[model samples]
Target: SKLICGSYGTLAVIDEVTIKTLPRPETSLSLLFESDDMASAVALIAGIFASPHEPGAAAILPQPVAAAAGIDLAADFVVVIRLEGIALSVDDRAGHLRGMGGTGGTVETVPQALSETLWRRIRDVDLLADHAGDIWKLSCPPASAPQIIAAIEPHFDMAFYADWAGGLLWLAGPSGADFGTALRAALTLHGGGHAQLMCDRGKSKQLIPALQPLPPAQAGLSKRVKAAFDPLGVLNFGRMHDGI
Candidate 1:
């Protein structure tokens, strides 16, 4: 008679779903800025943080990732910012961002349809299609993100892009890289980065488990909740935990 909606639903019968929606902006647009230097790209993004632009979505993409998305950006890194609202306001903010890239920074805006598609590629790591490796989905502190990427750069050549303002990153580690040691360490350098295996390219056993083991406090709380809701461990087959 009851239903669980998320991953745990596999363990039970589900019937209903709910989706959230946000207010639409009168005019929607995206900005693409490029610089060979990672620091310049990072600095420009930092400047954007103080500017008036309220981006609907914003991300930093490496050259490889940019190419994979068909962005035609030659710079080492590209900073993408999306604005959705009144056309006049959007133009003002877009202009402000373009102006911020005064030296060694080039900026451009793609059509609305193309812009949405590019952002989706970064969001989904679409370019990693057909690749065989683990994809690391990371959530880290916004300003410290650049430092994290900088730290990880020397170890391996990875394709990555970040939804900068959202503090989210999608990175695909190179094959044969140490997922347990190198990947996790890089994700944690800026702060305690919580990672989960969003998708496994190989679909085989991996050094880093799909999900990290829960901490005792969290484990205890979850145990208590599960007991109260589905003590029989019948809701899902170890959907959220080993037992249930």
Candidate 2:
């Protein structure tokens, strides 16, 4: 929790980090499950996280995105669950997950190389990096995710995927979408949460704020902390918000 990650150098410039390299698990397996039921798909994933077979990594990608990632599953949604540990333990946990569906769902093993490729896509978290559109990353509770997505769907047509077991949603929409109003309102309704505009390719660079506007109180505290580190405000100044 003390470590800073995923922030694009706006927090602190890490010259080096002494990280503990975990011993490689003797057996690592990636499991892929496909189904039309988004609710059940997410529920199964939730169950996995709450179970003894806690997954090392997990994600949910829609059919189109799954196809893009070369994951072939004959269903509308694909839940990717990865298990890694002792060989026998991994297999036993996987069997438990498979048995969760009985004859109702399709559970399959994903090849190692292919699994790596798909996870990389999820990690990059830039579904529309090249497009002249507004890209947003949202973080909220997993249970409230489907409702949030449901609300955002009618307002702006966007493609999305979930990571961290649906706690984070990477969504993209056309440029000039109402993030300040409609989109932000939807987020507030579900649960007051964080939403950052990753990029706005179509907007003028001079006008667009580097990140979405933070609440006034948080904005002030952010500036104070940044000043403690970079008093001159030299490192990526204005990249997060004005005057910081």
Candidate 3:
């Protein structure tokens, strides 16, 4: 099940469970970078990417993601990078990433205990609602996350959490989501941003668009797409809008 989140552009890609589980000729390796500042955390990730050897996937966390579950983060910033395929090739690649970090950056295997907990925390947006108010998920490219988050803070006073590089952001609105064009304008001016109307307490039905830029073509396509996936629309019918 491909989770599409855009009307005109690709907002995010949440791979289906089966697609994620498909056997691949690859393996994933996790590298953690510790720092207190977000700049340092991002710097480390960028450095790893700049390396001649680029890994499969990389994640940066200002704090230990494990703490979101229960564990505490001793470091102010913890970045995780994963390399996949051919275990024998991993050593050199891992070494290349570590070398790029200079000193004090600990490159180690992501412990199973912590890895599983963080994975669940990132994928499970439902848990975020418990921490704050009306929750929203924003999916953009990794590099664009920080700037977008800053622009959003002024419009709505809320707590923020991010995943999948900076690409995915989760925030909870202190007030109900009265998201006007102001929110939309900020993102458009500064690159890209999209908001999903998560939970609204006041309305009988959801009041925001699930996907952005609801052009006529996309609006029609979304309906047909939904009908294909869920002919009954039993999932969250009318939650995005009247027609969906």
Candidate 4:
């Protein structure tokens, strides 16, 4: 089950599946911290995670991405932290989070309806819907994100935002750039992470891999697992990787 879950249907075919859904929180609130730079915005997110407020979701949206999502904040970057649960608990946490006071930015409380709408757009990557290029999803240690972004910025014409308190980055780069290579290089230089090409609208799709290459030991293990599941190598062959 563990091996088949994220295998992109390269393993066994499932006949049926069941998923358990949780009850939605009774109420939610979001705190928005407007910062002038990525570093400061990320730092504010870090501070929120360190506190006992326990945010349900946290993300950093740069000015362009925010504007694209219809967030009309007059700031360079916005750090959004959401708290959810019973009405009283959510309100309490939001109050504490607001008192924490971000560095070099004004903080605003977003109403519940607007908060839901904003996070939905972020989760769906709707802000980049019109981007006519390659989109990449990256995950690394939260603290290393600023450096990774800095490393990649000079090379590509791109737009990006961070979620999971800056641990996950969603980036859209020009169609023809060697974005996969450049992004992996930046990840290696800063800290090891995973990169996956989510959308491709140009020739680079044939030139670059959609997923990062696995390390030697991990690659061997994956090959062995694949053989166990599909001995004839016929099930979704090469869907995830070149040979296996």
Best by the lDDT measure:
4
Worst 10 residues of 3 by lDDT: 5-14
RMSD of each: 3.3, 3.0, 6.1, 1.4
TM-score of each prediction: 0.83, 0.84, 0.65, 0.95
By summed lDDT, the worst window of 10 consecutive residues in model 1 runs over: 1-10
Clash statistics: count for each candidate:
0, 0, 5, 0
* lDDT for residue 137 in candidate 3, whole number 0-100: 66
Across 98-153, the per-residue lDDT of candidate 2 in tens digits comes to 76653377788875666667677789964445444667778888877777878877
Q: Across residues 1-244, which tens digit of lDDT does each residue of candidate 3 receive?
A: 2355432222222445343365663455566766665556666667777777766555555442435544344776566677666766776787677666655656556644555555556567643646545666666666666666566667775655566665676666654436533455556776676766556544512454544556688779877877776676566675564567
Least accurate stretch of 10 residues (summed lDDT) in model 2? 1-10
Point to the candidate with the largest TM-score: 4
Error of model 1, residue 183, in angstroms: 2.3
Clashes of 2: 0
Q: Which pairs of residues have clashing backbones in candidate 4?
A: none
Model 4: which ten-residue window has the lowest total lDDT?
A: 98-107
CA deviation > 4 Å runs, candidate 4 = none
lDDT (CA) per prediction: 0.70, 0.73, 0.59, 0.86
- Per-residue lDDT tens digits for candidate 1, residues 1-244, read 3435444553455467567898867777888888676656667777777776776777887787777778787888878888878889888888777777757456888867888787677666786664566677777776667777777767775666778663777777754336535656766666766666676666523454556567788878767767767667776757656754
Instruction: Give the clashing residue pairs of candidate 3, or none.
Output: 27-84, 27-85, 29-82, 29-83, 35-77
